[model samples]
Target chain A: MNVFADAIAWIFSPDRASGALPLSEAIWTHLAFTVVSVAVAALIAIPAGWLIGHTGRGRELAVALSGAARAVPSFGLVLLLVLVLGVTHKVGASTTAFVLLAIPPILAGAYSGVEAVDRRVIDGARGVGMTEAQILRTVEAPLGLPLLIGGLRSATLQVVATVTLAGYVGNWGLGFYIVQGIQIRDFSQILGAALLIVVLALVLDALFALLQRVALPRGVSAGRAPENEPVRRRRRGPTAPAPS
Target chain B: MTWVTSNLDLIGRLSVEHLRQSALPIVLGLLVAVPTGWLAFRFRPTRGLVLGAVGLLYTIPSLALFALLPPLLGISFLSEANLIIALTIYAVAIMTRFVSDALASVEPSVRQAAVAVGYGPWRRFWQVDLPLAGPVVLAGLRVTAVSTISLATVGILIGIDNLGYLFTNGYQRQIVAEILAGVVAVVVIALVVDGLLVLLGRLLMPWTRGRRAA
Candidate 1:
């Protein structure tokens, strides 16, 4: 209605794009926060997850760590870090908090992906005289690719949503608009900024969904079809494609 | 320590407010999600569309959603209703997918056996399907509860009262102890809620315990 019209007008206004707090600048800042957070999280989490899955050691530690990480409220963490590190390092503090938010899912994905692979498959690889490193690279990595991508998808979504908090610490992002709009009581700008965030998140989700489909191995994709068949054939044994 | 001791009454009041804001949404979410999830599961064609919509809802940032709701619902900008409704949307978004998946996980053979036993669809869902799906649904509830509790703190940014009020107040005053206390209190609430849910699940699904024992 009128509100929607106002939101559209706000978005299209030349001042919105040209000012000190330009929408494009906010968008870029949001993207930078997401990219850096996700990349650093992957660097830390994926290797640890892989090692746990590969060696079957530290499974308990990973589980406990993920639980503890999940319990820590993201807003409080950001505030605490900002306080501890001093607000002068706002970007560093916020980035650290975002990285903490991003890690658990990626770690879970990598470890569970490898662990879900059939023991018989690993035995076969060993029977064929593959080295440990070769077995991981050739046998485990491809099969776990879908889940690894899934982990990245979850991490990206979380970071995108969370990086908005950066604005609270005086860092720049789309959240700045929402925060500022609230302060000034500008409904149109608030709605406009929110729309941009929703669009950005949906676009990223779709791109990741495409990546998941493309990355899935052909053999695994074939295995997914039988579950949908109408005739309740004999339930496939555990040998069916591993769940992503 | 001195800061926390002096502010004990403030902490208690905010904790209660936080609990009210968070817990109510979860209860409301379960009520809405069960039916919506049933619809998604009952109709095969709608499953993808329904789940996709919920997934998209979840990707909307909490802050944006909070701002969007006051205008959309015609509520006051600082209304507690806005916080509750916003959190409810998130809870529904998360729980619907979990409910649908949990139902889907019910074994075909088990469902067929219930059919052969002359159970109608409604009775079968209530008895066979729901019981089997209980553990998964409970696990999802635990996750939803913890996340909702964490998210309720975001309201402090917009001047709603919750444990996060401590963070904002502490930051403005440059009192590190107050911020740390907020962090500790929120984490403790999350852990206690999670533990209670686990205990409740065990009590309700005694068969799981029996199976493990056997």
Candidate 2:
């Protein structure tokens, strides 16, 4: 349709390059918000989750806390922070909101990932005279890599989606285009911005999927091959409930 | 404190609107997801396609989706229907996956036992599979409900009436207390809904309680 064509053209238009709302600038800003927020969230959540998963204590509390946190609306949070902190620190307020949004999934992922490791493996390591730290590092960490990465992927998606809200406070990211477009009744601009967001999200998703595959332990990955049905079944045994 | 007390009636009305906006999508989502999920589960070939489509829907940014709907649906820009429909799409997208997974979690032996006992496919699904899947499905419902409640707040951006209205109003008037009030109300609503769903799930799945007791 003409609308699609116009949006595509608008994105590459020379006039846009020199303007205040450059396409490249918006993309970079969005990415920065996502990366910074996810990094901070990972720093806070991954450690807590790792400790909780490693100790196998306070799991219910962790899950409940994360669930409640996830339910806090990012939009309200952003506005509340802006109001309380004053718009003087717009970027800081937005980053705080993004970090809050990013934490729950990453925490859950890291916790669940470590928890998903077989206790028997941990026991085996312990029997071999390995210390708790050694067992965790040598056994649990490697096996849990896939899930840790999975949590990162979930966190990334959430941050990416949420960072767009930063535009509400001011001229932030791709959301600026959508918000401004709506205000000015410019459909093409809105569509163009949305198209860019979709493409970015899809790219990130594919990259994480590849990372998940590559992060799998070699034996576990090999066990997934169709010809290795017996091995596959055995590998799954620890996770699956025991036969009644 | 005085600000909240003075605006209690307005806050109550906004909370009601928020509930209304959230509840409709969940109901609609359940109605659509059940059949679609069953179809995906029952048919091997369509499973990947169905889930892939739904997962893709989940990735769309809420604001983009909200903006995209008016043009796509030919509705007025400000229609409350836009919010409901957009939220419903998200609910169905998420719920479908949960429904299929819940149904998939029903033990094969239990299903086989139902079949062996001379139950037809419909009878087996209704009497055995569905009840078995109840807990997981209810868990999904709780998640969906909470997320929807939060997402409904985004409706404020487009000038739709809800708790988000307070966020915008407070921002415009520079009233931090009012904005904080909105935050508290939204969080409370989400928690209440989540708790109610948990209680509802427990009541409906008495077998789960019995199993836990043993």
Candidate 3:
């Protein structure tokens, strides 16, 4: 009860502003895992999506595969991976977990980004005799940037939260604190871990928002609501789920 | 077969109890979320805070969250309280988005007409807005339902036994049939619930088909 009460008091304590957390290490490790895994997924998924979308084939197959991937349940897959890969403190386990986590969002973003690219714009660029490479680099990247950023944002958040769960498998994460806190029934440690995670999520989300604006076309690139509008921090992924 | 034969009545009773317990938390969640959502919509500042609180609840792993709560509450402690609360937190987060959107989505023209007819704020809300928002709220409810079904599997860690009991039991004990049964039941339930939601969504919001198609 002290654990729970202390946690509440700690959280609701008037000195919350001055209270420190394990936020820094958690943030750094989480961001590294999230950013790297997502970047890698993008590197793979974007090209694949561009190819599939540009050709208007294989998109369904890729999406269906991702849908199947979603059903595998992250924890279950991680357990299986531990057996196959042999766990270590190295990034292998967490990276693999994040990779699986990262794939769906990247694929969704890339496909939509490509499909969402206006045909007329592509045609106009092509008419100027831009090669496929030039057209992709110039036209598609700018157009698909928002959706791509949206995908990355969601993938990052999902990875962070799931990574917490991953800690129990001996992977050692901020979730280490959470799982440990739970065992001893320590609320401060648990709450501390939880608080650390949320702050990290929001910060990473903000960074992505900044990156999105810089990465997107002038019209689409606005941070949350730039200059005046309220910034709605919506992290989007969510593929079409099963027909049901 | 032996397990079932030996524990036939126990199995039956447990299933019934589990269903009842599960349904209560889910219903409680939706009810709480609706009012929170309405207030959040009314007071914009509260929206983020409420959703943030709910989201924080969600990020806490199911077992850990449950453990934290039950200790504090005591026989105000049912074994299922934590699961209920965690599930409710999730349901609220998703449902809040649905409801707030639904309320805001009430057509301004309709609101204007309601005002002209001297329907006060409460009347406009109850009669005009709620009716319009029904489908979205249902959709949110369905999402909550499906999500809850999945989260219930985590209940195994606490020995709070639901369908997950079957899988965890079988897997740990090396009983293949039990694991298969559990896995099948969960997957089928999720599918059925999801399909039902889609059907309900369509039935409730016939107009959504056009929107989806477009």
Candidate 4:
């Protein structure tokens, strides 16, 4: 009957959700909510952010919008969306709400990532008769991939954590535990729900860390070239140090 | 002309009410979080974990985060204290990041210089470190301020009155003007508050102007 013991048991139990299965619809629904939102946010953010970053004027507005997006509370944004579009709208509306939550990091990442790509590298790719797409595909994306992954890492963690609040609008997730916990004054349930959220965040972050490593393109490591090794020897003529 | 004619007064009233809702929590939240951050720096492992916990705190949905408080604290259905508590937690999340980053940024050379001058750690922290770190801390404060202003809208989702009430209420009643007015008010407040924080940062630390500009 000890609370911690009860919580640990429930957390680890193989068949906690169903008659025979451990995971429940609530858990799956939460996963869907997070997945759909992150997907939507990324789809919108990447190209738009990259395009803006490529243009000198584009960076300011994109960054400003992201700044505003981050400033607004996720719950408030949700409430606004729910009002304009009812909860029953499901995928269309609910996903939009979560997308708002997911976007800031994506934009921040894409914009900064594109800008941070080495110009010399892009130029070299172009000189090799590579098309713009080829240059981006072969050069820029490889270097920017880590930052992009970093953004997804932040965005995914945020979506999972905030997804629980969706339960109040008839979408069940870990918020069920918190709601149920409060109704019974079961600290165990509250702790379980809270722990699930923390686990979800860490688990999601770890998976992305793995993906970032795997997803990163070849011949470009995130680290700067190793110590005491020359990255570029002088071109045998007076040349200015390359501008960042 | 038709729309503005009908809704002008209402927009003005809502703006004042929302500012009141927003300012109270931000001022109070900063008061609580800044001190907690200061206390946090004195300890090591615990401070790191506590701040990490705050980062996690950033992940919680603001509405649920607020609602859960009232139940646990045994407060009434919609307590101001509960609102403040939620705001405080959000504030702490930001303030901790600010304080820790700012403090960490203090160069070791400066600390060494202070010690060399017979200034003890406490004296040095109070005199040199805190002042030097003040601008960064204030930069974080500016971010927290902008975020808190927008978040105060979550106040309406619970039971407190704020601009969100306009949006929520208007939407429930199908009044487009109220909803638009509310959104505009929250945005304006955010913009103005951000400007003020920048101004305050510059005025408080003239050194911050160049740092920010550069």
Candidate 5:
């Protein structure tokens, strides 16, 4: 009870604000890390993913790579990068690690989004004399837009959560406060910093959810099962045999 | 490499602790999520609310969740319970949606046939729905296990002892080998456990064999 009160009070206090790393600054820094990393990742991954999906090649390799990547612990990745690259280049190393982490989901989403579009539809587009470029731009990109956004959404969320750890490597971000709080054993400070992160994450999630909804094509939205159902089912792979 | 060879005992101890920390949450999460997911599946009105809430829960950052748990649960910051409880919360949040989906994926006709053949709701779930839902739930469990095992490493930030300790210790010491040891150890545990789950699925669901390439 008192802890909650103190946390709220701590968040609002000018004392905490006037310190070396202010809460507002932390928020911006955290967002910057997330934005920069995800942007770089999207630039690198989306094209490769589209090529793979459009040509229908290299999907097995991509899926296996992403699955393996998912198993690497984020904390270890951060530290390993910082160590390998040297602490002086910690910022670059951390960003590289974040980019590596973000790439898999975005790439998967890109290729799978295109792959999910009905084969008949693509064939129909081809019969109408649409160039491959026209087919990719008009037929595949728009229909696959929702899932591309989903991949972006998850990648953003992942980067946001991970940007908190940026402070561990001496980068200034919202995680700085949590790291500082832990070192000092200040429960209020830890809770307060965590609250800031939670709010940021939820706000971003809501924004992305709205984006996903808005991006949904009206025709598809009309017949689609719930928003998450398709995403879940896609990952179950082809081997999920129907009950005989 | 020498760091790893010299620290084998420490690494083994931490691996045991990591496995223990991760296992409880996976098991407890399935136990809790099953009923809740069944409720969401059985009841129409609560479906949106239940699924939406858990979806939001999944978005909460793992570190933030760990930090929030101590104050919210009135547990000491250093308690191992904090790590387990936070991990369990994640597992439940991740698994509930899968459970609901797994149940929903059960064939409607199969369910109807079970009901028509004199099975009560409880018996039908046990005999027909659950077995049918098993593969999907197991799939979700594998994902949850890998993620939970990976996420457990974050507890080192809050002072909990586990394989994650190697990360912080190595970072502070600038020992790249030590850090690599931690990463390899965690990944191996995840892979081995994931393999075990696949085997368990095969043994328990023999009918699923030769049907698909799992």
Candidate 6:
């Protein structure tokens, strides 16, 4: 009980800010790693996913790649990259690992969201002479918004969780306290840092869940949207909704 | 290459520990999740509350969870049990959702038919509902298995011995082969476990094989 109280106090103590990387700075650095990695991943994966979903090609490749990627432990990957790239380049190495980790969920979400839109609707849009790009922009994007956000939600959560690993490579983050505390056997510090990470992750998760709700197409939410049926997160072994 | 060749004994021991540590969580997770999932799936009122609570558990980062569990459980920070317990919590968090979803995947009419044919709830759940939920649950189990195997590597950070020791040790020693060995071993374990899961799913749910083939 006293340890718990001290952990709580540790989180709020002014002395915390006196660390090599101040507590606030550590948090921002963590957020920065998360945001930049996820953003870079989105840039590469979303467009590639859109292309795959639009053309209805390369999906098996996507699935297989993501499956293989998921099996690579992020910790080992980080250590390997840092070693391979040279420890002096730890930032690049860690960022690469983070981006790779973030890509799969976002890619899955992007492609699956677009694929979930009914084929007849795309046909209807085409029949009315909407160009490919326009249909993707106006029709598919709106209908797929909920799922795209879902993918982003998962990606963001994954990256946030993984960023806690940054300290292992000598980059500072909220994980520093936990990592360093473990070495020195400081239970209060470890618990406090863990508490911070849990709180931050949950808050972000909640925000994404809300975003998923708000971004859900009105028709889909109302249960009247046949065109967007089966918008739920793809089950682990989900076959790509068969292209009609 | 030289490092791996010379360190075969160490690698073998670490692999065995990794397998043991990861496998326990998957089994324990399934034991807890099935009933919790059945309850959440069957009871309308408890659905959101149960799901929301577990969903929150899933959000706690693995490293943080590993750090946080020691004091809470009144265990040593370096106990192998701490890693197992934390991974089990994660497996439950992940598998409970999948188990419920898997149960929900069974058609209502199928369940109704069992009830109509004088099958008691227990018999029906065991014979009909459970078999029907097998594929989806199996899918979820595969995910839980792979992830647990991978996440178990992080146990090294807390000083529990596992393949992840390679990562920390390799980094300090600048031995890339040692790190590569760790990554390969983890991936191989994941792939082997995943393959076993698929085979087990086929064995348990023979009906699914015909359906997929058709």
Give the candidate number with the greatest DockQ: 6
Of all native A–B interface contacts, model 5 reproduces a fraction of 0.57
Please compute and give the TM-score of the first chain of candidate 3 against the native first chain.
0.78
Evaluate residue A68 in candidate 2 and report its C-alpha lDDT on the 0 to 100 scale. Answer: 79
Q: Chain B alone, TM-score of each model?
A: 0.95, 0.95, 0.80, 0.88, 0.97, 0.96
Write out the backbone clash pairs for model 6.
none
Measured by TM-score, the strongest candidate is: 5
- Every candidate's TM-score, chain A alone: 0.89, 0.89, 0.78, 0.81, 0.90, 0.89
Task: Rank all candidate structures by their lDDT, best first, as comma-separated numbers.
Answer: 5, 6, 1, 2, 4, 3
Candidate 3 lDDT over residue span B41-79, tens digit each: 667678777766654554444444554565456622225
Q: Is candidate 1 or candidate 4 better by TM-score?
A: 1
Predicted complexes: DockQ each: 0.49, 0.37, 0.16, 0.16, 0.52, 0.53
> Can you write out model 4's per-residue Cα lDDT over A122-193, one digit (the tens) per residue?
778888899877666666666777677777777886677567655544536776666555556666566556
Runs in model 6 lying further than 4 Å from the true structure: A222-244
Superposed model 3: Cα runs more than 4 Å off: A1-40, A51-73, A80-97, A114-133, A177-203, A213-216, A221-244, B1-26, B39-78, B104-107, B113-119, B164-184, B202-214
Tens-place lDDT per residue, model 5, A1-244, is 8888888898998886678787778888899889999999999999988888899899889877777676788889999998999888988999998898888888887887788787899999999999999999998888777777778877888888788876787738878888888888887888888888899999997998798789878777321355334233443211210000
Candidate 5: residue A241 Cα off by (Å): 24
Candidate 6 per-residue lDDT over residues B1-214, each given as its tens digit: 9999999999999999999898989998888999988877877778877888887888888888877777777888888888899989988887887778778777777888999999998999989988888887887788788888888888888888999999999989999999999999999999999999888888877887866511
RMSD of each: 4.1, 4.7, 6.7, 7.7, 3.7, 3.8
lDDT of 1 by residue, A88-179 (tens): 98899889988988888888778877776777899999999999989888888777777777778888887887777667777388888887
Model 5 lDDT per residue over B22-135, tens place? 999999999999998887787877888888888777888877887788777889877789889988988888788778878887877788999999999999998999898888
Best first by TM-score, ranked: 5, 6, 1, 2, 4, 3
